[model samples]
Target: MTRIDSLRAGDPPRIGGYELAGRIGEGGQGSVFLATAPSGDQVAIKLLGSALTGGDDDPGPGFARESEILRRVAPFCTAQVIESGLLEDRPYIVSEYIDGPTLQQVVEGEGPLEGARLRRLAVGTLTALTAIHRAGVVHRDFKPSNVLLGRDGPRVIDFGIARALDAVATGSGVVGTPPYMAPEQLEGAQVEPPADLFAWGSTMVFAATGRPPFGMDSLPAIVNRILHRDPDLGLLRGDLRDLVAECLSKDAARRPTAGEALMRLLGARDRPVGFLLSAGSAAASGSPAPPHIPDSGDAPALSPGASRPPPGAGARSRARRRAAILGAGVTVALASGALVHALTRDGAPARPEATGPARPLPEVTSVPPPATTELRLPGLGTTLHENPGDTARMVSFMYDSKGGSNHYARVRGTNRFEAVAPWQEPLPSPDGTWLALLPWLKESTPQPYDFVRLVHVPSGREYIVRLTDKPLQNFNPAWSPDGTRLLLTTFDLSSGSRTPVGFAIVDAAAAKATLVRADTSGAPAAAPFAWSPGEPAVALPFGAGPRAGLRFFDLNGRTLRTADGVGEAAASESPFAPAGKRFATGCPGAFASVCVWDTATGRALARFRVPAQSAFIGWYNDAHVLLTDKSADPHKVVVMDMKGEVLRVLAEIPREEPGENRGTFLFHYMRWS
Candidate 1:
């Protein structure tokens, strides 16, 4: 590992819960310091530059983009972000530190890569891109230097922030290196995921040949070569050569998606798709696991001394040496996508070939079940099932804006109010940085559904997603415990209340949504359900009134066959814990009683009649049940230790009206910070 230096003259000793060890790396946007977490884990804390963070009250896009993206694509092929908070008014983010050398250092020092080694690098990086895309994000600055070849494998870093910065106009200083830039980028055009593919091709070419696709040259010359010339592959052959060429296709539409690229790189038509793979971690008990890590031979590792030249040597120097090495030449007309053409230096034709024949890469529409689950949760009963630290630590609420046009939310007990329409409810993410707003399109109108608009509260940035190709409506957006995915119920708005539609799992970043088949009974519609806080199964309402029972579905929305009695009981109004093995709900027509059910069997394990006119709030933990005694003076909530003995009264609230309940969190995931 590279040695960690001591704090410099300007460095702060501590930030939030992390203590600085020393500066490990620095980039154009910020400085990265090796730090120690309160729990003693090693972390890399990045202090963002002032230009990106914005003024004290208003931060720019890149300031929060990386954290938001990392939060959504964690535990995959990335250095997961742990927490983010300001230090002395400047923003800082701490992420799990990956000890490894960049792809640049490895290839540069070890010479050109080939065979299994090259295959591994390609597969690993491609898989990383796939995961990022799956989460609704695009890595605009995807180059060798941004990839860390760790002990476990390659991890993609600096994703969203780069994209946001790269979007800034070129004359003001573009974010990415010119040699690795797509032609469209150089032409000052709009960039997207397709741009990443072009950069990926350049990266692969550099890795395999120890030179950029375009030979190293002056900036003007490199720009000309990129726009007008075809990369000189020079002896590069086989499937690798073909794939790289396709990735560098002048036409963006002709390029394959990250997923498709991965599938083709592994030869989908040849293997079982995952014909060769690395053993990846299993999914959270009973949930769908992520894609496999491609199995490949051991590649050369980056030694501590393998660190590249410092900033004093300049980023352009390393970028030039590792990116474009083409001779000087210059122009071409602007076009769609990130590619261009040119008239040669001596006014010759650009090149005879068109980025190969426009062959399409195989598309992987969905990720197939790779392996059987090895971890099973004991569905003993429901208690507090989710990580409630963040929610439990603060009381989130909404208030009238004194007859103003919109309502406001007191986020995280910060006393800082954010204006949200009365039609919206502020459900903060587990990290407390984002708030998911479920707004009724027409609150005064009697509509059957609503859509969610995710807002980064601190930055005021929002991601409004359509979730469909047509003008469809969605409702009841539920945030998963990790806040990476959202569970939504789709409604055929035209169908009215007489029918039921289905459910969908949305990638919070990319806005890509998949419809899940939750209604096996073929009903026209169904009520929205709450995910069991942690796993894939959700407790959904199948029918109406007392006749309605709860059905469980996996993340893909496939019905899971449980004990026959399980679906026979009515779903309670209280929220299910994230990983609860048991659940507690009050009997519908009761003399006021609380009941705990075996989530897997639909069998009641315990029942306790509470004081008159009371309702079950939720389970405090696996051993305790929380219920409200409305019959008591006003309404008092009490926690019972499962043995019918009252342990403690948690809180007291005003009596709720017959059809109105002031609390819904009793049914949602909550965590104490």
Candidate 2:
């Protein structure tokens, strides 16, 4: 009776000698149902869905062989297999029903588990794994979704993909969730009992933190973290943390065996333990980490005008700065010279306790004290400068080096300094706290997947903004001036054609996106997009196409206006000015000049001619702009006035002629406050 859904239409009332009661769950393998056996005992029935058939004429002799191996597994901390047979030519396996919810369900509904409960889960699953391994079977997929919280104790279930020890142990194909898979499994190396131990460690981390240890960012990012970066085990303290870390070791040979891990868990306890609570009995829990939106299903509606500040926003700002280290590379100084902390736990300090009754305000303060202003800077190539100057402390930029292309960010003075996912471009939020990334995949062909990945730099929390049920391809992610929202263009690929569908506005904090479906027939392949600096309107190349100039649209995707006077432009810098009164773009003509346009009327404001070699980088301020002066001898980042005047130089760049600083982009990209 633990969280069972009623049987749906077309579901058989009776299979073999068992009567179906209700639905337990459905997954990649098949649907599971709660049923009563011939002996009138409660049992769980699994309708086979995997391709494990030996021949078409038979209902999978492989199923029988696999079920025999599963039956050899001791019932200790495992679901005991009762029977296996072909019912109506569909392969099925029956096992003793464990009345409980999955660990994944518990964590998602409640939060993370801690202390003794956490220890018990770790112990129980390891016990089940030990038995499975001793029986010569390797549970290939041992994630949170597999561990069931039964009334007796935690029981491991669904070994549909398990392979016997003597079977073909290695294959080119990889099966299992990306985040929970071990390094060897990902590399297509020989997977053994050690891989299960690694999964156990990952599950333990997920149980304690309510997040995958490597983070649930992207398939590429998760694979990168699993292979390279150390896990972000949030607040998993003491001896348990050490054991889990050892289990998660990248080297599979170094990871303890299932039996060895069981011994470690059992031997560590100094106090006697009683029975653990069933999933239905345990109360929901919460973590000290920042609240995260669920990954699946529709996200909660975002509150209007509600803003979530980045971590370490208040008094703990300095502490967070001290802990800002690159993900896996050279450390950078945030405060003075301190090691960067992992993005595992909340860096915010504990709130102070109330001393006594509240006191009345003495008098009206002169004016509220100004907010704290911290220094910030960007890392050019492998080196980072501590002097932030007057630039915004939170900034995201890309630099290419011998190590390859990487995206770096300085949030509240901390840098996601290491290239978590190499060759990816990250667009920083206006405040420089959150980052919107289009995670790069090394696939042979273009994918139809459409979703924007957002990461809170301070806390290392990640969320996805999904707009549609159908597959899509998103491009041009532009953050609003306030950093609370994002504007992106969506493409439909249902007909195997990449057709321009419409645009979407994503609520960053809420992890929710609204699709403004449109008929973009005349839009260019790559159109320039931007959110209005003042109002909620967005300018995009709509159905009328680039010939229509900048077409403005509201949240409902209604066309507000079309400024044809702006004309067709090839934008090389940010289109909108900081003050929102004026915008700039590279003029489309043989002369190639930087043209300023009025935002309200879209009329030409001013034109500043530039050297053909020099390119418009971005707006320096409302009155000035920045240009990359490659025409200069040393190559400089120069500031320019609205008029055709070079005001001052910002930074002089060292030229890489041929043999010098190969594969390094030093000071090639720059941004200011």
Best by TM-score: 2
Total backbone clashes of model 1? 41
Model 1 ranges off by over 4 Å:
52-57, 60-62, 164-173, 270-673
Clashes of 2: 2
lDDT of each: 0.51, 0.57
For each candidate in turn, the TM-score is 0.40, 0.46
Candidate 2: residue 154 lDDT (0-100): 78
**Poorest 10 consecutive residues by lDDT, candidate 1:** 333-342
Off by over 4 Å in 2: 1-394, 400-402, 411-424, 442-449, 456-460, 467-471, 491-500, 541-548, 572-574, 632-635, 652-673
Best by lDDT: 2
Tens-digit per-residue lDDT, 530-629, candidate 2 = 6665677766643332344666767666677776645444331136665677776555343436667788877766666665556455565566655655
Model 1: per-residue Cα lDDT over 510-582, one tens digit each:
5445655455463314345566634566656554333435666676566765333222222232234323666
Task: Single out the weakest 10-residue window by summed lDDT for candidate 2.
Answer: 331-340
Q: Any residue pairs clashing in model 2, and if so which?
A: 323-341, 325-340
Global lDDT of model 1: 0.51
